[model samples]
Target: MEATGRLPAVRGIDAAAPFRWLGWAWRDLWTTPGPLLLYGLLISATSLALSWAIYRTNAAFWVLALTFGFVFVAPMLAMGPYEAGRRLDRGELPRVLDLLLVRKALRQDVAYLGLALLVIYFFWGRIAQIVYGLSTWQIYRTIPEFLTFALTTAEGQRMLLVGSGIGGIIAYGTFVLVAVSAPMLLDPRASVFAAVATSVRAVSRNPGPMLLWALVILALVMLSAATAFVALIVVFPWLGLASWRAYRELVAEAPEPAAARPLNPVATR
Candidate 1:
């Protein structure tokens, strides 16, 4: 989606948007880490439970993969900043328990997220096929005087490189879209498409900071893996709050009134 307009000009490139985002993120952590932690635990538990159930069933690879995709959508409603925003606006503290109670909104969000995931998966599948075809061609070319040897070597390397590239593209797209869409979805005023579009445009316009953000996310994911995924309890909430704050910063808004009461912060369902 196209950016609404060029990013607003500020005084110094050195004082960039991401640094400002970092500051907002820090403030959220300090003021509301308890709520964030609760949200994270809810997300992590449901996700792990779904994944373990699928794994234990010895499901087909594609079946397991699709189930995993569905699992991600389920938690989006719970972990999404948009849900928090809605709750905050209503003067309710965001809580994991809200997910159990907010059935209608949760269902609506799940449907929206599921549709997005399907579209993403369709494109991703095509990209995977392309890489597999390339790999097969490479293996065929690598077949030595002995057809078996050269073919196998060439195919393996081709598949490896092409698969990696496809994965990278998918990862980058997911990051850009997921970054802002959740919060947008939570806002009663915003449409899902608008949120996704805005997110994509935000990253496109601010490539440098977005890259740094992506790196930070990746590092967190790596650290989580090292901790047997336990680190996500902290990392997920931190990033979720960070994303909400980042969305507010990147998107334009009117200045707050000097004497107005602070906006109520809510958790997304």
Candidate 2:
């Protein structure tokens, strides 16, 4: 539904807002640990799968691609915590089933948005491969091999500079699209295009605080990746909930339903 009459006013937040969002997210995580933790476990499994792929192929490029690629597609995955935060805000405990229910609810919007991101991620991987190929003819079989070449060779340095520069642009674009749209999609009244518009507008109106938020996300995601993604068990859900906080602060808060219901209800007999 397009609110062409008066667009939702995006509030201008200060740099400190991102830190505040993190605090709120921390609270949301502990309040509904079961569902949020299940979400984290799923991320852990994905990390393991990626690690297995990298090890099997001995393709260090994949490692680099996935390391940054996660930030590109995290909003959709973080939908679980966003839903949890929404329920918790409504004075209800979010059930594990909401994980599935939230996905179902945003099926149309998320599918389109998620696909757009997946395309960008694939393009990024291809570009990374090209950069690596140009920089080094030899494929690295291990982390040490890759790091030595990357840190010592001029070609390797150039590749790092170019690849990261392009990746940063892509990541910023993805952030602008979904920083608020994912949560907006969760709202029963919001349409995909409308949510996207609001998200872009929100970033445009509050670039300083939004950039701070983006940096916070990058730092946290990098930290999670550093622990072989083990830290993702907590970082993933924490960021998800934190994103919900960001959306809440940026857009005018939607009115909660008068009567709350489980995200997923039992099937009728």
Candidate 3:
């Protein structure tokens, strides 16, 4: 069950395709505005609650790390949107309860993928803590103190430089692994190995578009976090829907009507 029989062919795309994906996401968002917005709110609330807990405990360092590691859990968080997108793609009305429950993702491989992401998250946290510990013996529990030290001290600058470099590498690897895999798993035939392999191929074949997509996602998600997750109510759903669009185009080779296809459609199932 490690592989989903065989890998699906990846379609190449132009770098500007991510923008169109966002447009499609916007269009899809309105199809079931109430359920989708409510879904986004639910996730936003969960994220806010987690962030509040960290802030409450005065874990300033973790708050910063969590922001950087937010994408780690994103694929898992995106299940609902992916479900909605897939339903919409099939010319079927996306069921409210189905989108809400995301029952399709309650499979063994999904659990395995979630565990992998969880491990990556904790590993990144530990590495970030080590970097901070090496930079300064004293821990800054408060946000103001941490921000001041991180912005002013030479050691803090060095820590930021090194940590960012390491984090970027890890993030890119995670992106490749989860990009198509997450949504691909919704199919009963998908396995962790096949999904990951297909995702890697999708990135490898369309490096430019994939990187552009990754950056767009990063910028938007960070912007949402910058607002203390208030924007996440909309941003997360937008990105999730877009991610699902990306997955369908890159992983599944389903034929689409001319009106539905974006740019040059490449269906190679």
For candidate 2, give the lDDT of residue 69: 87
Compose the digit string of candidate 2's lDDT tens values, residues 1-269.
45453457677888888988898788778877888888898897798688778867897768867788888888888878878877766667888888756754556776888888889888888888888888888989877788888889898899889988988988998899989998778875677787888899999999998988998999999998888888888999999888877887778655343344422111000
State TM-scores per candidate: 0.63, 0.91, 0.91
Question: Judged by lDDT against the true structure, how good is candidate 2?
Answer: 0.80
All candidates' lDDT scores? 0.53, 0.80, 0.83
TM-score of structure candidate 1: 0.63
Once fitted onto the true fold, the runs of candidate 3 whose alpha carbons sit more than 4 angstroms away are: 1-4, 252-269
Give candidate 2 regions above 4 Å deviation. 1-6, 103-106, 257-269
Clashing pairs in 2: none
lDDT of 3 by residue, 96-116 (tens): 688778887999989999999
- Residues 78-129 of candidate 1: C-alpha lDDT, one tens digit per residue: 3444444344444455665553354434546546865776677676656655
Candidate ranking (lDDT, best to worst): 3, 2, 1
Clashing pairs in 3: none
Give model 3's TM-score versus the native structure.
0.91
Please report the candidate that would top lDDT against the real structure: 3
Give the better candidate number (2 or 3) by lDDT.
3
